[model samples]
Target: MKRILTTFALCSAMIAGSASLPLHAADAVSNTSAEKVLPLNQRMAKKSPEWLSRGIMYQINPRAYTPEGTLKAAEAKLKDLADLGMTIVYLCPVFVADDDMNREFWSPRQKKSQMDSPLNPYRMKDFYHVDPEYGTDADLKSYVDTAHKLGLRVMLDMVYLHCGPTAVLIDKNPNFVKRNKDGKIITGPWKYPLLNFESPELREYLFQNMEQWVRDYGVDGFRMDVADGVPLDFWEAARVRLEKLNPEIGLLAEGTRKENQLKAFDLSYGWPFSGPVRKVFVGGASAKSIRDSKEGFRKARPIGGDRIIHFIDNHDISNDDYENRTEERYGEKGVNAALAMMFTLDGTPMLYCGQEICDKNRHSIFGSKFGCTINWANAGSEEAKRRQELLRSLIETRNSRPELTFGELIWLDNSAESDVVTYLRKLDGKQTLVLVNCRAKPVSVDVTLPDGVKRHFDLKDYEFVIE
Candidate 1:
């Protein structure tokens, strides 16, 4: 049976005339000739000049980023990455893997039991320390320092769902891990041993570790992994605790589930919407399917005033599962359009490590050590060059338009026959109309802008412009 989920949209509708918060007008610049964009949303009104609500984000897999394979090397590329319009840099997994080489590599005996990789950034071997392979403690400090110097906020990949077999939680405090009926620890791939959040000791340890990261490293925030597995109460508690460390410390959840919304997560992965949208845009599914999935996501997810991370593909798809097949289906042209849609929509966009160059090398965390590296050689290709530039432009466009970031989305199905997906983002007093053609040919249709919109600005260069 198909499952239907209820969202805050319905809940708010039920309360109708009753107001929860006031909708304030945006200070979006009325001057069309202005060269630079302004951050005028309600959320950013009180923030510092460096405060960021909408901008580009870059994802770097340290191991694959450079031959040196160290945080220092990743730091060297900050300038290049910043040039691409990155306001944030998300490092996948920087913590040390299992110390023992034999224990680190996944073997036949451990395959079924492991839920993640020995190198999985989600499984922490040491909370207070940095992985020697990635870099020393000082090296990590430099990475964060350089990122901030470059005007980019750094977010660490916080994997709290589980820990490694020989981690402090498992060896020192056996009570920290979840156990089965027979008192045996429940195991999964990647050797993930679940944390016992019910225990105060375990909860305190996790919270303290989080607090240390904020106070010591000056890390901007956390990109929590497997957020769904953790207890909601634990997160709500963490949210309160984390704010004490740094009120500006952002919270981003890796999972896309309904229950995550009511708690402390500031941003959620729009996976349900992204997957179906990509499939439909890539010709794997029908336009009707895309529309239905988007409608479902809108109805189910309580995303108003909160950020949702939108993407065409991340490491899970770009590096592993969907790698080999994506190029054949979408080709260079199709992927560019897909990136445009992902970045321009009403969400914070996420770019997987290799997506900038159409890295279709089938990234593998379990494959050959050197094979895991990004094929920098592919950057010379025309297709790769085009995609890279297209992504940069899209991100730059997003940075220039605050309305696209915090605005409300109004999807327009102008010509389903032509496979065109269009939408208008309205925030404060600014509005942007984005039209993305998913089909092979150019699709055109007359679009009516909101009253007085055409008189103030021009949007014709864009697919569905007002003036």
Candidate 2:
């Protein structure tokens, strides 16, 4: 029997007026009348910074971003990213990684890198120092400074749940790490020692490290890795202290916990929607699956202010293998359709380093031993230039139109729900219609809006239109 997941209506009633309500009153309204409930769009705008809503995020794996694989080299590309319409540049971990070449155990992915001395970026040896492989403290400061000058916000990937066995924290205070009944340190999925959040000393040390990034490096925000592994209270406390330094500091949780947004984070990963999205294009899933997954997420996380970060590719996905890349699995045209849905949907969208040019090379983070550096040479190719233009235009459209950013997403019923997805983004009396063909063939869809106006679309393979 095919299990049916509870899904939201495809043609739900349009969200009505609640525009003037203050963001601070979200809690009070929830306790009051249903009619006074704040809409999702307004709540998001109220909770997050205006620039965040209008901006697109670009994830840069420093190891693969440039041939040099150093902070100095990556700094040179800030203007190019800004020119490409990216307002946020999220860098993967650059902290001093464990270089214990004699370590017996290695994860499968690490083994794939085939490095004699693997330096997985996630395995941190010291929280305060930059990995010599990437650059020095001064280089990091310059990178952040350069990004700010180019009108881009830099967010550092923080691996807080676990650290390399020889981390300074463990050496300073062995009790800072969690241990089993036998008094052996507990190892996480990546074979790194897990930090004991219960230790107040450990908590204080990690909190201070975060403050250093903001104060010394002038980082605009942090993307917390394996955030769910840590206690929510810890994140809440960290946010309080960090906000005292920079009120506009953003927190993006790598976990799907909805409550992360209530206070600790500005956005959570849209893991549920990502799978169905990929299936629609590559696995021949119904277009309705996309709608179903999104509605499922909304139902599970009913908070109006909650937001998600949507992406088709990121460091983890790309490093897994070349065949897993969106461009590799579905080709450029299919990637275009996926990108359209990602950017147009009611959430913040993210792009991996080479996604704008549709680069299909795998970017391994363990090391460059497997020849995993991004192929910048591909950027000069004609096909890459065309895809770049498409991405740039999509970002420009999203940034210029406020409705697309915080708009109420109202799914419209269409004749070809199996292959076509239709919706409207309505905000402040303005509405933008979006039609997407999820399949790689011609789709004829007849969509009817809430106002009873019907429109016909002859969408070519994986094509999308926004008007």
lDDT of 2: 0.76
lDDT per residue (tens digit) for residues 130-237 in model 1: 888888988988888898898988888887777776786677688898898888886555556677888899999989988887888888888788788887788878
Deviation (Å) of 228 in candidate 2: 0.9
| lDDT by residue for model 2 (267-310), tens | 77767567777777777777777777666655534355446777
What total of clashing residue pairs does each candidate reach?
A: 13, 0
Cand. 1 Cα-lDDT: 0.60
How much is 213 displaced in model 2, in angstroms?
0.6
Sequence-dependent TM-score of model 2: 0.90
Q: Any runs in candidate 2 off by more than 4 Å, and if so which?
A: 1-46, 102-105
RMSD of 2: 6.4
